[model samples]
Target: MQAKEIPVSKSDLLRADLQESLSHSHIDPAQITTFQRIILTTDGTLTEILEAYLYEKIQLVKLSQEIVASAQEIKALDLNIGTNIMNRKVLLQGKISRRNWIYAESVIVPARLDEIYRERLLKSQEPIGRLWLEHRVETFKEIIDSKRELAGELSDYFLIKSEDKLLSRTYRVFSKGQPIMMITEKFPESYFIDK
Candidate 1:
């Protein structure tokens, strides 16, 4: 599917004062209420929350690993999980920069033994392909909004946080991080590229 750019001004997106209101933890109740209404109207479920968070967390793990190799510090990352049960689209890009690379080495925490066991069971019962992530935020405000969207994506992810802030993610951050990365475009099937 083709993608469309979000129609928001750079300055509006980079607004400094509202940083606290961007994430699930900080947004005003009214703002959250709007999202709540949307979810309720669409009959969203608890499982959707878990699905989005799991996807986002897996993405950050890879990012943290990539950032570890660099000096930039990734203060925050937002990974777009996917369409919800209702198919509302959202976009997020986990991002890092040379200036912040030293601070951006935060990644998702490791899973518990029970989780590992569950994955083992699930893998045996059903084949699952590996997920991928890309980073795209350019400023702190986007970072904050992304986090909230991430929380909205999956409430459970709210429990996941920056642990051992210096740890590396599974994927490589590479030499220069892209500001507009398409982090997780899961292509399970091999498709033809014009180029």
Candidate 2:
């Protein structure tokens, strides 16, 4: 007799998608490197993780920040199209080694943020996770996607060839049961392999 098929849950499907995305970079999910695995799965503050792993403080270098209207594609932030949002980009680097570790882009709904949080986010170079901690904001991060792609313009920041692969993840942060920010973080696939 044929066995009955079990229904796949949404979380199960997401796991499958993540595995497929990792495989595109030639990574076997079962045999993924430590940092690569962390990058794929961790829903916590990456800046702290980098510091703990590298044994060096991390620096937040703000690249650019601007107020812009949200696009229809920005469904992750749960903002209406044409709503004002803070579009920001930055790099997380090793403070002592001066090595760029990760590049991140964030779309934040300013209206959803408290005045102090908005001010600090726009004016300070603090990592988002750190800001959340300082203000004692309760947050939940849900990873929405993961993939591998060519570095392209990001190659300049990582000092790698444009053809090099980058492992990336996109997630949305929610506070008070509302989506507050959507962020994407990317790092070269070749990094954090040896140690």
Candidate 3:
């Protein structure tokens, strides 16, 4: 007689999918280093985390900021297609070491944000996490994706080879029960290896 097939739960499938995704990116979740795991899973502000880890102040260096009409691909932000969104890119670097620790890109729905928060986001060099803290914005972060990938163009920022692997996580920030922004943060896999 053929063996009966046991049903797989939804959560189990999801867990398997996440593991497969990580494996596809050449990362084994079970074997990931502590620092790498922390960077991948933390919902807290990375600016503060990096500062504490490196024992140096971190700076946010703006790479570019532009207002562009978003496409349908950004359903994660829950914004209508063609809506004007702020596309901001920046690097989180060690102030003393002058080392780029992380690269982040944010797609913000300006209309959903308060004037003060929006203004600071546009004009201040502070990290988004810092701005969230300074403005006292209550936010919920939901990590949507995490993976490892070739650095490609981002290699220039970390001064690493293009083929080097980068560990990254993408998350959506929700405020007032609405998705306000979607951010993707990446760092060189070699940066946070020490115990």
List the candidates ranked by lDDT, beginning with the highest.
3, 2, 1
Candidate numbers, best TM-score first, in rank order: 3, 2, 1
Q: How many backbone clashes does candidate 2 have?
A: 0
Best by lDDT: 3
List, residue by residue over 19-107, the lDDT tens digit for candidate 3: 55465666666567777777776688888888888889999999999988987667888777899899999999888889999999999
Candidate 2: list runs displaced more than 4 Å: 1-27
- Model 3: lowest-lDDT 10 consecutive positions: 10-19
Q: Write down the TM-score of every candidate.
A: 0.18, 0.86, 0.87
lDDT comparison, 2 vs 3, better candidate: 3
Could you give candidate 2's per-residue lDDT for residues 85-120 as a string of tens digits? 989999999999999999999989999999998999
RMSD of each: 19.5, 5.3, 6.0
Which residues of candidate 3, in runs, are more than 4 Å off? 1-26
State the lDDT of candidate 1 residue by residue for 1-195, as single tens digits.
Answer: 889887864335423433332333343324333333222122122124323533332112222222112133333322333211111111122233111111122232112113553344223321111211111212211122222222222222222322311111112112124221211211101111112
